[model samples]
Target: MNQAIDAIRTFNRFFTRHVGAIDARFLDTDANLPEARLLFEIARLGPVLANVLQAELGLDRGYLSRMIARFEERGWVARDRLDSDARARPIRLTQAGQAAFEEIDGRQRDAVAHDLESLSATERDDLVQALTRARLLLDRQAPDAFTIRDARVGEVSQVAARQSVLYAESHSWGHGLEVVEAETTAAFLRNSDAERERCWVADLGGVMAGAVFLTDEGEGTARLRLLHVEPFARRRGIGDALVAGCLDFAREKGYRQVVLWTHTVLEAARRIYARNGFECIDTQVHHTFGEPVQGETWRVLL
Candidate 1:
């Protein structure tokens, strides 16, 4: 553990120096790294609460307040009282702030591009993969780092393929399961109602770590399907987040109940479903996926 700690500290020091993080002016801008980061955060998360920002950045409350005061003095940001909570004020970037953030972002991008230009394409790819793995390992220790969002175009197919591959490797399932996944995904895409059907991908950092889908099952019922978490991303609350997001979306769409089907052998998924208030409604042995397996249907009333 001590050796690991020393190694991490060494890397932190090297990375800070390599990125010119110790420089007073970041990307040749008037704002330092912290200030520039604050501006970027403000731009990314519009109208963010100051307290939230302070907590996220791990800045002292007074230091953050002073920084905001400086931004306000420079006409770069504004704070407005929340109507729902008058005592709480949210900070937002001004026109000048947005322009400044853009400049800083462009410069930072250029700097990164310049640094990567020295590496071959394959080397760059390896670097990216290594970084992704590092982030996944680190983020697994930080529960709040995971985010659930709508899956982007072309990602649904990828999710389906990943699920098929993972299941085949983990459970000795054959191509039948893959065929079923493909057909279901295709049908969902072809016949889904945008207002009723939704799919969410859990992202750890920039990687798609898990996915879940909710589709209309008629009679005000929503079916949860294609739920999966990558092997490297398990035990980090990602499955729970995906399931919860599905149930929340179902509730919002006026679903009277949400249902799911899973194999009894998938104990982790079963635990997730049960923890989310789903009750086992039925179980039957089936030789549908190349083997005799007990398929269980679970439901939760919203």
Candidate 2:
């Protein structure tokens, strides 16, 4: 209890000192924190809709409207309607707002620098290590779990749509480039209850960004299909996590061999597969999107 109390006190002191307490002089009352933060957010992600800000920031609509009005009055922001839908307005920072945001951002960084300078290098490293350990513990203690239900009902449509776009763009294929139909994918998800096939979706913050599926071809062989991570979720280790989940499930189902088919052009996927014990076992030359391409087959022993 005493140790915990000490830690809490340390955290409070750190927060107060670094994040500006009532008596803090670094950030004067030139503007309220909310307005300053709003300015920064607008400058960082301008041309973003007000609805998006409200959702992302959990701000009340009335409050957001008031802030936006203030920004507009100051000539710091401009609102424009979408070309396709004039009713939908997006807010963007004007030149004046951008300049103000840069000034505020510089000040914020300087404040952080001041706080960091007060700590010795070893102390800073120690603080970082502690924070990292705490973060990992929190993540493991409450792993962000997505509903592991049958994907075919409605969610598979989402996976198919995004996956189709990814493949179309990367392969330069136009129109009707979706490799798998929704009906087929839905059937696969629906039939996977017995582990004869499986599709797993990793919902990060309520969005399906990572997925891996398995299809049993019978005769002791299983195929890993549709292993993909959405572009926004890349580099977050979601892809690896999804693959690991799929492999664990496949192994538990007594699969002897697992195979995956992917284009050789996708170096990131290939690297991930290789790191996860998949070896390229076959390759075929084919024409896709008016260009010659090589498709590689990778296999792993369960």
The top-ranked prediction according to TM-score is 1
Model 1 scores worst on lDDT over the 10 consecutive residues at: 136-145
Candidate 2 clashes between residue pairs 3 or more apart in a chain or in different chains: none
lDDT of 2 by residue, 51-162 (tens): 9888867899999999899888988899988889999888998898888788778888888788779999878866765654455444554344444334534666677777
lDDT of 2: 0.74
RMSD of each: 9.4, 19.3
Error of 2 at 189 (Å): 4.5
Kindly report which residue stretches of model 1 are placed more than 4 angstroms away from their true locations once superposed: 1-111, 115-130, 134-144
For 109-128, candidate 1 gives per-residue lDDT tens digits of 99999989999997886687
| lDDT assessment of candidate 1 | 0.88
Error of 1 at 242 (Å): 1.1
